[model samples]
Target: MTPSVERVAAAAGAWLDQAQRPMVLGLCGSQGSGKSTLANALKAQLEKDGRRAAILSLDDLYLGRSARAALARGVHPLFATRGVPGTHDAARGIALLDAIRAGQPVILPRFDKARDEPAPQGDEVPGRIDLLIFEGWCVGARAQDDAALACPVNALERDEDPDGIWRGHVNALLAGPYADLFARIDRLALLAAPGFAVVRGWRGQQEDELRARVSRGEAQGTQVMDEAGLDRFVQHYERLTRHILAEMPGCADLVLNLAPDRSLKEKP
Candidate 1:
C-alpha cells in the first residue's frame, strides 16, 4: 500500500481496536486530495483484518438538481451550482449515521455527477458495519466567521455574488445542520493539500480522468465539465477549502500534510 493509505489504515485500525460500538471516521480533504483513495484503502485493510466496514461519501448526499433549483429560488442563485455546504441534504446524512450506530442494515447513498442527481439505486450495508468511512472534500468543514464572508474569494463570487449573500448562506448551513452531522464523527482525519493552487490542478486532473472514463463508456457524459467549466466550478469551493486548510489541521485527530504531487509531506 502507498504511504498515505498505510498511515490512514493504521490510524483507523487503532481506532477500531478500541471502539466498543460502530464508529464513524470522517476523512476531510480538498477536492482531489485523495480522500476516496484513503477511505477505500482503510475499508479494505479493516476487512482483511476480519472487520466489516463501509464508505459513506458526502458527495452522495448532494441534493438533486431539482432540489437545488428550489434552493436557488428560495436561497441564493449560487445554490443551483453544487459543491457548497447548503447544497447537500445534511438531515439524510445524520439519519444514515444514526441508523449505523443503531446496528441496523443501511443503504449507502450514491450520486451521479454526470446526471447531477442521486443514483437510482444505492449499495446496501448489511449485518451492522463495524466502521463507516465517511469521506468527502468537505466532510467535516466548519463555517467561516461572518467577517470572512464579506470578501469575495474569486471571480465566481466577485462577479456573481457581489453582495456575499450566497457565501453567507453557505456559512449559515455549515454552522447549523452540517455542524450537527459532522459532530457525529468518532474520529476525523485530514488529507491536507499543499495549497489551493495545487488543488486546482488536482481537480482538473480528476475531470480529465472522468472524460477518459466517458470515452471508454464507463461513465455518463451529460454533465462532464470542460476546462473552463471546471475552473469556475472549483472556485465555488475555494473559500471554504482555504478555511479548512488553515483551521482544521490544528484540531483534526490525524493530519497528513501532502506535497503538491499529493504525496505525504511528513510522517503523521
Candidate 2:
C-alpha cells in the first residue's frame, strides 16, 4: 500500500478503536491534492481488515445546474462554477451525515460531472459503516482572518484591487452552513502542496480527460477549466487553499505531501 494510504488507515483505525461514538475521519484537500486517492486506498485497507468502510463525498451533494445558476444570481458569480462553498446543499448533507452517524439509513445524491449537475438523488451507501472518510475539495478549509473569504465582491476582488478589501459572505457560508458538520469530525488529514499554480496544470489535465469522455458521451460535460479558465478557477480556491495548508497541519493529526506524480512525502 502507498505510505500515505497506510498512514491514513492507521489514523482511522485508531479513531474507530478509541471513539465510543461512530468515527468520522475528515480528509480535506484541493481539487488535485489527492484526497480522493488517499480515501480510496484507506477504504481498501479497512475492508481488508474486515471493517465496513464508507467514503462519503461532498461532490455528491452538488446541486443541479439550475439551482447553482439561481444561487449565483444573488451571490458572487463564481458560485455558478460549482467549486465554491454555496454550490452544495449543505443542509441536506448535514442531515444525511447526521442520519448515518445516528445509525440510520440515508440516501446520498448521485453526481454526474458530464451533465454538469447532480444526477438522481437516490444514491445510498450499501452497508453499515464502522468508519467514514468524508472528504471534499474545500473541506476543512476555514475562512476566518483571511481576506479571500469575502463574497459578492466579484471574482476580481484581489490584492491588486484599489481598496484591497474582501466581503464576508463566503466566509459566512463556511461558518454557517458547513460549521455544524465540521464540528462532528473526529480527525482530519491534509495533503500539502505548493499553491494554486500547481492546481492549474493538474486541473487542465483533468478537464482534458473529461472533455474526451464527454465527447464519447461516457461523461457529463462538467465545466471545463482549460489553460486560462483553470487559472481563473484556481483563484476561487486560493484563499481556502491557503487555510487548508496552513491550518490543517495544526488541526490534522497527520499531514502528507503528494507530488504531481502522486508520490508521497510526510509533512515535516
Candidate 3:
C-alpha cells in the first residue's frame, strides 16, 4: 500500500478501536476520488488486527440495466443512467444493512459496471461483522431544496433536461430512501478532491486502465467508454459532485482533502 493509504487506514483502524458494536463506516467521495481503494485498505488493515470486516459498495446495489431501462421508459430518460440517486436499489441496500445488523448471514450484491448489469451473488458474509465499510460516490449526499434545482449545472441538464425533471426526480430519491440508507452509517469519512474539474481527469485515467485491461484480454465484455462518452457519462454526476464537495466536509466525521494529482493533502 502507498503511504497515504496506510496512513488513512491506520487512522480508520484507530477510530474503529473506540467505536461501538456493529460499526458502519461510510466513505464518500466524487468519482475516481479513491474511496474504494481506501475502503479496501482499511478492511485489510482491520483484518490484520484480527477484526472481521466487510466492504460494501453502493455501486453494487445499482439497479440492473433492464430495470433502469424500465425506469427510463416510465419516469424520465435520464433514469437509465446508473450513477444518479434513483438508479440504485436503495430498499435492497437498507435490507442488507438491516440483516447484517440483525446477525443474519448476507450475500452482498456485486454489479459489473463493465457489462452494465449485476454480477452473480458474492460470497456470504457473516452477519456478525465487526465492521462494515460502505463506500460510494454520493453516499452521504442530501437532497437540495426546490430553489436550488432550478439552475442547470451542465450541458446534459441544459440540453436534455431543460425542464429539470430528471434532476428533480433524482433529488427526491436522495431526500427519501437514500437518506434512510445513509443514516445507517455510524461514522462518515470523505475523500475530497480539490475540485470538480479534477474529476474528469481522474475518471479518464480509470478508463485508460480499463482499456489496458481489455487490450490484455483480462476484461472481456466490458463496455469501456471513449473520451466523448466519458465526458457525457460524467455529466450525470456533476451536479451532485459539486454539492457534496461544497457541503460534505462540514458534516463528515473525517475529511481527507486530496490534491489535483490525487495525493493526500494532509493526514486524516
Candidate 4:
C-alpha cells in the first residue's frame, strides 16, 4: 500500500529475475522501522508473477533467555540483554536458509517472548523454498567494534549528557562462525528514520500498541517496551547503529524515510 514499500518490492523482484539460484534479500532496519511490512509487500510482488518467495524473520531465531544468560556468563553477558548478533542461533539459522533454498519443506524455529524460550521442537516441514526474505532490526546491520560505543548516542548527546552505553557483540558473531554465510547477501535495503529520537518515539508508540494487543490476547508472547524502557533499549542499539545511520546514505540499495503519517519518501 505504501509507495516507498512498493518501490522496494519492485526493485527486489527485478533483481531476482537474473539470479541463477534463489536470491536472498535482506531487509534491515530498527524495530518499528517497518521491515516486516516491506518484506510482505515484496513477497506480494514476487507472487504476482507466480514466482516463489519465502520469508524468515531473524527475530524468530532469537536465543532463549537461558541460553542468552549463559552466553553472557561466557561470551558477552551484555549481549544476552537484548537483540544483537549473539542473540540468534546462527548455525541453525544458516542451515535453515540452506534448507529453504533447496526447496525442501522446512519448519523454522519459533521464539516465545513471554517464556523467553524457543519451541522445544521446531516447526516440522520441508526445506524447499525460493526467494528467502530474512528481515529484522539488525538484519543487514553489521557488527561494530567496541570502540564504536565509546561515543554516546547523537540525539541523547544533543539533549544533554549522552551517557547511554551500547556495546556490540555483533562484531563478534559476524567474525565468528557465521562470517562466510552472512557475506552472501544478494541485496540489502535499509529503512533509515530521520534520527534516533524519531526512531525511539515510533518504537515506543508501536510497543504500547503491541502491549494492548497482548492485553487483548490477540497475540501471544509479544514484545513490549515503554518510553522509559525504550530509552534504555535504544541506547543499546544506538551504540551499534552509529555506523548504520551514517552508512545508510551510501550503503543501502534503497533507502526509505517514513513520515509521521506512515507516508514514504525516497531518500536521495
Give each model's whole-structure lDDT: 0.90, 0.72, 0.87, 0.70
Give the best candidate by lDDT: 1
lDDT value for model 4: 0.70
Q: Candidate 2 deviates by what RMSD?
A: 3.1
Give the alpha carbon lDDT tens digit for every residue of 104-194 in model 3. 7899889887778888767589558888889999998999889999999999999999999999999998999999999888888888889
Return the clash pairs for model 1, or none. none
Worst 10 residues of 3 by lDDT: 3-12
Clashes of 2: 4
TM-score of 2: 0.87
Q: For every model shown, what is its TM-score relative to the native structure?
A: 0.96, 0.87, 0.95, 0.84
TM-score for predicted model 4 compared with the true structure:
0.84
lDDT (C-alpha) at residue 3 in model 1: 88
Model 4 spans > 4 angstroms off: 120-127, 145-147, 152-168, 219-226
What is the per-residue lDDT of model 4 for residues 1-268, given as tens digits with 9 covering 90 to 100?
A: 5686577767877787777777778787776787888788878877886877777788788888888898777754465665767788888877877766556678877777667778676655454445888887766665556666456555643343334222434566656755655565678787776666677777777888888899999978666876776787776566556567776557767777766545676453
**RMSD, every candidate, angstroms:** 1.3, 3.1, 1.6, 3.7
List the candidates ranked by TM-score, beginning with the highest. 1, 3, 2, 4
lDDT of 2: 0.72
The digit string of per-residue lDDT tens for model 2 on 91-147 reads 887887787677666676778776776776665776567877888877776657654
* Candidate 1 Cα misplacement greater than 4 A, ranges: none
